[model samples]
Target chain A: MAKQILSPLPGTFYRRPAPDQPVYKNEGDSVAVGDVIGLVEVMKSFNEVKSTEAGKIVKFHAENEDAVMAGQPLADLE
Target chain B: MPIKRLLIANRGEIAVRIIRAARELGIHTIQAHSTADVDSLAVKLADEAIAIGPPQAAKSYLNIPAIIDAAKKTQADAVHPGYGFLAENAEFADACAVAGLVFVGPSANAIRMMGDKVAAREAAMRAGVPTVPGSDGRVDDLETARRVIAETGFPIMIKAAAGGGGRGIRIAANPEEFDRLVPQAKAEALAAFGDGGLYLEKVIERARHIEVQILGDGHRAIHCFERECSLQRRRQKVWEEAPSISLPEAVRRKLCASAVALAEAVHYSGAGTLEYLYDDASGDFYFIEMNTRIQVEHPVTEFITGVDLVREMLKIAGGEKLRLKQSDIFMRGHAIEVRINAEDPAQNFMPAPGTVTELRVPGGNGVRFDTLLYQGYTIPPFYDSLLGKLIVWDEDRPAAIARLIRALHELQIGGVKTTRSLHLALAADPAVASAQFHTRWLEGWLESNATKLAAE
Candidate 1:
């Protein structure tokens, strides 16, 4: 079965903390459960969103500054 | 006087609307959004944007502290709550005042007075507006309810004295039904509005829901005419039209006059709508309630009167006088608006949120589409599924209908299903065409014709 991804909450997604910061993870990056992959910012507070399943990053489906709904898939892991 | 900078405290099309109006008046705009609305069209269009909170509206749009903080950070002179969420919330208004930021809506006192249905009804009666005859006030127990019913007769409606949405309403055809439905209505009312206060009203069957749009400045008020919002599904308006076709000239005059009178009596300020229920058979109208903010169907009135209601609200907050006298307001043509929601009408109006692969809005003379969407834009499912509003105006009702039909047909939105097809079918229905509709008419028609609608 494909690894399921979940949104931390409703918020905008940023691949990195700052404009010049490198992305924490990219496509094909191996990730373990509880590993931080991206940041979700709400009300000026940046939250470190962690992976719930250990897998390889299959796709970066959400763009930076993109609004994401709760439970929406932001990335695919396999 | 032009506003320097204005902060929009809500999301969706309303935020876009405020930005456009503010930009048109040469004002810098600040857009505030939840984490889930960072990429919303309004954010892209505004001069600046600040994140408020997470996707849930309670923590974001409805979070007064967060919104105030954003306003102060942006150095915004005013904040506009574009209907729903905290639009009519008195506490938010107070918070804005405390933060020294102008709230581009009614005063907190006006909202507090009108927010309670029972208080509003009483105020309307005192202002000489006709109201439904029922219990004098909230019934405390079964004994009081029985007594009130005995005085008012059967077929009464038990309504949440603090409720606005159709949520906390129960209709009892007789005493037996009343005994069972009253408790249920009270419980639902408490859950929905956080107030168990209940009032009774004589259920007016087959009533046409009409409302008058009013603009006030605390000292004087003017009415912008009326709109017939009788086309509803599950007590929510689906289609709205200005200058109701069924209302006689005398009734229309009385309705508008009464609305102005009520607003003046309250010393109301800013934009508000006075809702009424018209019994066509008896040629009588009764005050229902007052919404102390810009309404969702405001576009219909704007199309006919050419008024920028949001701009007026901002000016009113800045202590501007009534710009135009009552004589300046006159209906030019018939206008109709249909809410294009991101919901499947065939699936009991379930929300259908997804990325838009393609979007083509119909544009022509007398047609306007207010939306915050673009190609490849994903609709977040965290909020209301109302993607946009399709409005059209023409010389008459028939022309408006024709324009609406053409616009709906020409409009193309891919990636997710919408209520466009349902509106198209509703427009073609003969009963809707003839304007023989009530609040329950659309739901009843849809129930019996769901299969037919789906097949089409």
Candidate 2:
């Protein structure tokens, strides 16, 4: 079963740290606990979305700039 | 031509403000909203609402084409780009004109000129207004910079010509830091903005944030006193008042006149504000920039002067001249406005967007709350956190503070931590009551008081 990474805040999710930056993780990318998978931007402030369970990356549920809610699944890891 | 149908190209409290003024003037309203704001208070109040884009402001509120198209489709005669979003965009104003819709603000040329920091600085200089003592223009080399620094003195700001909005800024408290940071600033500026140009300006350490309200009819202008917004957090004004207690009667007159001169020089139209940094110690006021729209804190000025600023903006856009003279304006009493944002003041003001489980609005002879909140409304997380403004007026400054304290007790919002507690704490603070503070005072005050914000 694939474990899900949850967004800690309700905001717009981004795959990269910045507009010109690369995505923090890609499909099949290795993940570890405390590794930042993406960012959740709410009210103009950005909060990092970190992986809690170490596993191989499966897929991202939300695209960049997509509005997200707290506890929403952002990524899946096997 | 008088605006028959108006399209509001913004959201939140400001959009609701414009709509109320338009309705009173018997104008039809069309609200341009994003998908996320379909349930907003503005949409509910407007005659008709149209979706412009998705939730993100970049594609909706800031989307010029979508806003212009919405206006055209709704057959609106004018578009009011409330305070933020494309309010200061020169191209947006021009686009409104190109579509034959009246832009309810200044001319595009005025917006462009004031939008440029260097151009606005030069304009202020030409109008005989005081500006922060700084280098004349962008410094390309260190030799000229060093020479300029000798005249401006210590504690100067090293700003990138290509950088703005608090980016690419370095503070040099002394010559040593200046020497160390100038080269780093250049390299960073080149890497960030593709230009290594820099400028220098003296840092007024104990300055108060003062701004004058002005109304123009494209040919002449008049001042409407001033507002003191020294209490700010992260450059966002949290509390504001009219008729600054610190300014002497003579200094107030001169500061207001300079603002009028600058506005008339540019043939400004509609409502605008000229921001200044005032040093009470030296009794010097310097023009910083201009906001070419009706501001959020205009209500405090309105509470004191009895001049409806937003209504004046609508009238000016309808081709009306300045109805009141400078002599007609009078400061009646003290008024104050506090911004209520959806953030947990106890939790370092972390954004707290959630449903309003309960709402209790305060009311009285001199109390008013301009808000976009209602019970069960979920605050969308796509934009700023400003939820409303609580305004109060009284016979005197002390009385006004008393009224603020009274009204804040009556106001309530459940299910979300707000800045209400912080405001309550500030109202009871001795330093704030005495008005013994500078622009940087609140940040330092928050350091020791934040832990007690919610406990109050």
Candidate 3:
């Protein structure tokens, strides 16, 4: 079974903490219940996105720096 | 650079407005829209349309790189950022410069200078324009603020230097409140603006909100008189009228001249508005801030001055000097604009985002509706709730009010709730009709009369 990690806010989603940094988690990488998977930038403020369910990363549903709405899927976890 | 094909970097009524103005200038328009506005009226009316990103504004409207790419991709030589969103964003203007695109507005330095409230006040003061007395710069300590307060007196407003859209303001009426509010205001400013810059201003009691419209080509600017926007709800202007019926002729001239002086001092170009707080008792006005882009209430100014502000901005961007001198400008008649929002006034102004099942817009010789709505159009939930603006122009204030009332009654929108009924009631209200309302009067009136108004 796979579960999706939903974005908590409507903003631009970032895959890494900074543009120069590496990806926070690659596909097939293991994740914990409270892992920081991404960040959502709104009004020039960045908020860390934490995974609620522990599982291996399946795929990212949204592109890095893509505008996402609240409750939209960011990544799928298996 | 000649602005042959202009890209409108915005959405909603303003985008629709830009497209119309661009068409009048014989310039093709490419409307950069979000995925949510694929079927918007602006998209339908534009010469071409491009989807920059998804529904979220941060990715589409506020995304600097995406907007620049769209301008480049469409071969647009210029970009016009309408009010709100990134209209006042200095970095966005700088990015357009970096991309060799003519930004249909002022320089990035001017935007940065006037965008900050503290800096704007300082500039205004240097230009011999009176601003509300307060701290000269960001206040970091309570003792320093207290000393300033001792001179300026109490009932001061602690405002975020970079704040707009009516956010980041705290009022302290006494010493205890001042002590408690300064830190909270600083923290909120830091969170919102990414800077903890705070400044104070004396609260002018029973003040009327007046703004002067100006046009410049970075060399000389001319004022198009003033508009009174005192009728507001929750700090958002609900209705606006031009050549403020409240102002004496001498005071009006001084206010407009002061605005032009400040703009000249800053070498401001394009269309901009200088907002002021008028103390009716003292018969004096204090400069508040300057909006570096075309304002939402600009139509009321247009109705009086007969100046197509958007067209002038485009011409200025294309390297044309301002043709309309101060003597060339003339005020014709009184004009009133009522903002129709997609919110139920009875239900606490609740958001009513849905499809417009039916529509009947009012029109005549003097009534005009600036909206992005049409029959069968879906009102997206992602943006501001403004549905349209009902602008009525007549020979005088009373006649304009009568026209607005008739237009409001004739206008209808089905499927979603709107502020139409509220506007109708406001138009009929004796205080509003007589031009006796202040900036805070609408909220108080809504609290007391919204239910009755809704029932009617």
Candidate 4:
């Protein structure tokens, strides 16, 4: 079964903190529980969406600058 | 003066409605979209489109500087705030005036007067409009609250002085409940309205929520009848109808006339709604507050009156006099509106957002669907879950209800859950159909029917 990472609030999804900065995580990247995976900016505040389970990222379900809702699957991990 | 170009400073169905109206008047429209709404239907329909900022409304639609900059860059002469965001915001109206762009609503002073609940209540009292008996003003402490409760009697409602939309309120039936509820209500008021200022009011049982729509041209005003919005959940209106069935003809006239008097007292211009809580037992009504903008349920009034309220607002902002007199306004048919949200009713109204794989909207006769969705359009989950409003009009309430049922059945949206089933259930309910409900009726009905609804 794939472990899904969901958005905490409604906001724009950012694959990385800044446009030129390295992404916190990427497809095929290994991550542990509580590791930052991406950022969801809401109301000028950047919230880091952290991984709740240890896994390797299989897919990023949302694209950069895409609007995401609360509980939307942001990424798929295996 | 006709509006040469208009900028919609909000999003969703209201934006589409305004754009359609502007188009009919031969006025060009510019739509400001957040990053998430680049491909929205409103953008596609506008004469021009500009990306304001990111998805979060605070950075995009609600950001004064960004919205003003968009209007300036697009050279749009007027900004129409369609109901939400900065629609009723006084500061935004002031900013628009300073920028030399018409705000397309009430003056900033009128908005400020109605925005503050305490001040509005005081104003209503001074205007000889009946208000719910409560504390003199903002209660100072527990001692003051205790005294107020003693004087006002039990089963009183504690409310935030600056709050609206039913937020930051608590009902206490006795001393025990009052002690426990006051602190929580105060904290919520502080967090939501930025003011812990609290007031007390005797809770009116089985009160129907009715509001009168008034249009003004700075010098004079007239009433456009009343709308019954008693069917609500979480204090947010879910279904609304014109010509409330529960109110008597005399009461309705009085309520509407009182609303016009209040508007005239404030020299209110543009479109505004004076909300009231009406108790059927005593045929008594009390002023609640005023919504100083084009309301979400304006379509219902438009359906009955055949008046293009948005167009009238634009013309008024352009310094035009009232075209229609008081006697010219007449309610014809009964119109009902259901807010279709991208939410799962079975899952505690949880947001359900996804791509629209298929889309079908009802048409013909009195069926109308105002939406910004199309096939292949992804519903960005960043903002409100309101997909659109489904409104139907007919000669009577029963006919309107029948039409609504047919319309809901004909409407189809795929790849996301919606409130269609819930609305269907509510429409079929005897209480809703008979128009026998209060503000808390829907929430209670939803809770009790949750099990049966889930079984399906």
lDDT tens digits, residues B285-390, model 3? Answer: 9999999999999999889889898889999989999999999999998999999988778887766677899899999979989999999998776788898999
For each candidate, give its TM-score against the true structure: 0.86, 0.96, 0.87, 0.88
DockQ of candidate 3 relative to the true structure: 0.12
Give the candidates in order of lDDT, highest first: 2, 3, 4, 1
Q: Each model's DockQ?
A: 0.04, 0.89, 0.12, 0.20
Q: Which of the predicted structures, 1 or 4, would earn the higher lDDT when compared with the native?
A: 4
lDDT per residue, candidate 4, B330-380, as tens digits? 999799999998888888877777888888999989988988788999887
lDDT per residue for candidate 2 within B1-456, as digits (tens), equals 888999999999999999999999999999999999999999999999999999999999999999999998999999999997889888999999999999999999998787666677789999999998998877777798889888988888998765543468789988788889999999888887677878888888989999999999999899999999999887789999998999999999999999999999999999999999999999999987788888989999999999999899999999988899999999999999999999888788999999999999999989999999999999998899999999999999999999999999999999888899999999999999999999889999999886678632
Interface RMSD for candidates 1 onward, in order: 8.3, 0.6, 5.9, 5.3
Task: Flag regions of model 1 displaced more than 4 Å.
Answer: A1-78
Q: How well does candidate 3 score on lDDT at residue B2?
A: 59
The reply for model 4, stretches above 4 Å from the true place, is A1-78, B451-456
Superposition error at B54 for model 2 (Å): 0.4
Error of 1 at B391 (Å): 0.2
Fnat of candidate 3:
0.12
Which residue pairs come into collision in candidate 4? none
Per-model lDDT? 0.88, 0.91, 0.90, 0.88
What DockQ number belongs to candidate 4? 0.20
Among incorrect, acceptable, medium and high, the docking class of model 2 is high
Candidate 2 segments exceeding 4 Å error: B160-169, B175-198
Position B441, candidate 1: lDDT? 87
